[model samples]
Target: MATIKDIAKQAGVSISTVSYALNGSPKVTPETTERILAIAKELNYIPNAAARSLKTRETKIIGIFLTDFSGAFYGDLLQGTKETLTRKGYELIVCSGKQSHWMLPERMIDGAIILDVTFDSEDLIRYADRGHKLVVLDRELAHPNINQVLLDNKAGATLATEYLIEEGHREIYAVTGPGSSYDSKQRLQAVMQVVERTAGVQLHVIEGDFNKEGGELAAKAIMAGRRDGQAAAAVFCFNDEMAIGMMNYIAEHHSDIQVGEHIHIIGFDNMELASYSQPRLSTIDYSKRKWGALAAEQLVKLINSDAVENERIYVTLLKGKSVGTSK
Candidate 1:
C-alpha cells in the first residue's frame, strides 16, 4: 500500500532523489541510497511497475498464448518456455481466450509466443506491423517482426504412413485434428501424398478434433465400416491424445478387437501416456521441450532486434507394440 512519496517523505528527501537512489543512479550518494532503501523497507513500498514500464518501455515479461489449457501436452512445453524465459531475465505468463489479445497490442508485455489457432493470421500480421515481436508455433507469417518455430508436420506424417506401408498394410485410416489447425492440414496433406504415390494403398480420412472424445468417435466409425472378416488395417491418429481415446474405446467395447493384431495403430506427438499404454503406442516422436525452448529463444532474439531465421523442430518414428505386420 506504500508509495514512493511515503518513502521519500519518511527518508527526508525529494521524490526525484528517492527515484535516483532506488534506481541506483550515480547522481545520488551511497549514504542517501542506503537511507532511502531503509525507509522503503520500513514502509513496505512496492514500486509501481506500470509507471516504471511507461518510462523504460519494457515490462521484462512475455506472454504465451494457447487455445485452451485442457490437455497434458502443455506441461513440458511450458516448462521449457518458462525456464528459457527465466534464464533470459524475463517472466512468463500463460494466456488464452479473446480477452488476452489486448496484452500484445497494449504493450503490457515485451513480446508474445503464439500457438493458439483462434488468432487470425491477419491480426498477428497487423501486430507485427506495429513493431510487436512474435514467435509463432502454429502457423507461418512473413514479417520482419515475426519469426516461426513450426513442427515438421509433413515429414512426421510421411514417416508414420510409410511405416504402416512397410508393415504390408494397404488399407490406411488417418484421423485428423480440427479443420482450423495448420498442423492437421499439413499432416493430412502429407498422408494423402503418400497414399497417392503408393500403389494399391486405400486411404480413409476421419475428421477428429484432437481430443479423446473425437478419437473414440473415429474408432467407432472405422469399426462400423468393417466387414465381418476383413483383414487388419492401419490407423494414424494425428496426435497421441486421440490415439489413446481410440485404443480405450476398442478395449472397452469391442472385446473381439485387438490393437497390434487386428488394428495396427500409430499416432503423433509421442505424449507421455503413449509409452504407458497396454500396447505401447507407435508414434511420431519430437521434443516438446525443445520446441518450446527454441520458440522462447527466437522470440527473445527478435525482441532484442537480433537477426534470426525461422526454425523447425524435427521428428522421428518410435515403434511400439501397438503396430504389427499385416495379417
Candidate 2:
C-alpha cells in the first residue's frame, strides 16, 4: 500500500506538509493542499484506518445493522438513507450480522442505524446504555441517549382492516407473522380492535414466520380443515411474502380460487414483486427509505446538536390495491 511518505516524495513536499495538506489542517496553504491531494490520488494512496481515526475522531461513516436485505424492505431503506446522508458528505457501512445477539464493530466509528432489529434490542440497548449515538428505524422505542423512529403499526393495520371491512366481507381470516416482531404484534392487536367493534364478525388468526413457506403452510392448514362458513372470503396476510405463499398454494391445487372472485388477498410492504404477481397483490405502501432517512437525521441532529434532549420521529400509512371489492 502506498503511504504518505510516498506521496510527499512524489509531491516534492516535506512529510509534515503532506500530513497537514491531506488531513485538511488550516496551517497548510491551499495551493500546497491541492498539489498534495493530486499526488495522493495519482498514487491511489489509502490512509491507514487507525491513523485516520485518530485525526478526525470520526469516520464520517454510519454503520447499518439489519437482518434480511433480500426483499424490497432493506433495499428501499438503504437507497433513501444513502441519498440523504451521502449528499451531505457521509458514507455508509452495511453489516448483516443476524447471527450475533449484538454487534460491536472491530473498529470504532461515528454513529449507527439499526433496521428491523427482530427482538434483539439487547445489542442496541447495550450500545445506548453506553451512550452510543445511534438511530433506529421501524422498532418503536425511546431512550434518553438513543433516538428512535418507527412506523405507526396500529394505524396502518387499522386502515387495512377498515378497508377490508368496507369491502362487504364480514368474515375475515388474518395470517399473523411470527409472534416476535414488533410490527407483527402491533398489527395483530390492531386487527383485534376491528373485530371487537364489529360484533359477530370473526377473524381467524394463524401464525406465520413472515416468509413464503410460512404463508403456504398457513393457507394449507386453513384450507385443509376450514369448517363450513368459517373459511374467510378474503385473507389478510402479515406481509407480501406470506401473501405470495398463500397465492402459490391457491394457484397449484385450488386453481378455481380467483382473486377478487372467490377469495381476495392482501399483503403488506407493497414490495416491487407484489405488483408483478398474477393478480397483482394489493398491499400497504410506505417509504422505508424515508423511514431510514428520518431515523438517521433525528439521531445525527440529536448527537451533533448542542441540545440536551432528543426528540421522536413518527411514521405514515400507505394504501395500495390489494383489496378488490367495494362496500
Candidate 3:
C-alpha cells in the first residue's frame, strides 16, 4: 500500500531521494536512510521481487526437474543437490510436470539440473540456444551452455548380466525400462551385447516401465515359463524398485519359488530397500548423491560462464544372497 511517493511526501524529500535511501544507496545520507527505513517499516513496505531480479540479473536460485516423485530413488539425490547449491550461496527448488518446464525459459531460475525424461531434447537445445545454463542427468546433449552428469548405465548393466552369467545362468530374463528412457536403452544394449558373446546364453527381454507394477507383471511371466521347484533361473530387473516388486509378488503367491533358490534375481540402482529384503538383493551400485551433487556443481559453473566438463558416475556390482549358482 505504501509507495516511494508516500515516503518522499511524508519525509519532505524527493522521490529519487526516497528510492536511494530505501535501496541503501551511499548517495543518500545515513540519517535519511534510517528515517526512510523507519517510515517503510511503519507502512509495511515490501520490495518488488520482479524489479530486484531485473536489476541484479540473477535470482540465486537453481531448479532441479524430475520426471516424477516416486520410491526412495530421489531422496538422496535431491539432498545432494540442495546441500551443494546451498553451500554455494544458492537455493534449490524441486519441480515436476509440464508447467514447471516454463520456469527455465521464463528465467525464473538462474540455472537448472534436469533428470526428467518427459523433457524433450530439442526443447532443452532451444533453451541452450537462448543462453540458459543446464545440467542433464538422464540424457546426452552437447552444447557450451549445457553439461551432462549421467550414470554409467552400460557398465552397470554389464556387471549385472556378467555376474549372473558367472553364476552359470544360461537362461537369463532381462526386464527393461521404458523404451524412451535413455538409461534403459543403454543398459539393455549392454546386456544384449554380453548375451550375444556368451555361447549358449539366452536373454528373454521383458518390457517394463521402471515401476513396481511392471516388475510384478514380469514376475508373472517368469513364473509361467518355468514350473514350480524346477531348475533356478536368473532375472535381471532394470531397477531395484522392480526387483523388489518381483520379490514381493513371488513371496506372497508362489511359496515354492524362492527368490534366491528357485528364481535367482539381480537388480540395478542398489536402492536402500535392496539390503533389507529377505534375501538381500544383488544389484548394480552407484552413488546417487554424488550424481546429483555433481550436476548442481556443473550447472552453477555453466551459469557463471565458467568452463564445465561433462561428468559420469561410475558403478559396481554388489553380490547378495538373492543371486545363487544355477544347478
lDDT of each: 0.94, 0.73, 0.90
Clashing pairs in 2: 282-322
lDDT of 1 by residue, 171-248 (tens): 999999999999999999999999999999999999999999989999999999988778898999999999999999
Rank by lDDT (best first): 1, 3, 2
- The TM-score leader among the candidates is 1
lDDT winner between 1 and 3, please give it: 1
Model 1 stretches with alpha carbons more than 4 Å out: 24-32, 322-324
Query: On residues 128-150, what C-alpha lDDT tens digit does candidate 3 reach at each position?
Result: 99999999999999989999998
Candidate 3 error regions (>4 Å): 2-43
lDDT of 2 by residue, 1-327 (tens): 889999888888899899999779989999989988998999999888777866766677777777666545577778878877887677877777554324344336577777655536776677777766767764755666567676777777787787778777777888998776778888899999988999767788988988899889988886776554343477789888899889999789787656655667778877787878877776777777777777667656755753434333333334444444433
Error of 1 at 58 (Å): 0.8
The RMSD (Cα, Å) of candidate 1 is 1.5
Best by lDDT: 1
Considering summed lDDT, which 10 consecutive residues are worst modelled in model 3? 318-327
Q: On a 0 to 1 TM-score scale, where does candidate 3 land against the true structure?
A: 0.90
Q: What RMSD, rounded to one decimal, does every model reach?
A: 1.5, 3.2, 2.6
Error of 2 at 165 (Å): 1.9
The global Cα lDDT (0 to 1) of model 1 is: 0.94
Cα TM-score of candidate 1: 0.96
What does the lDDT read for residue 192 in candidate 1? 97
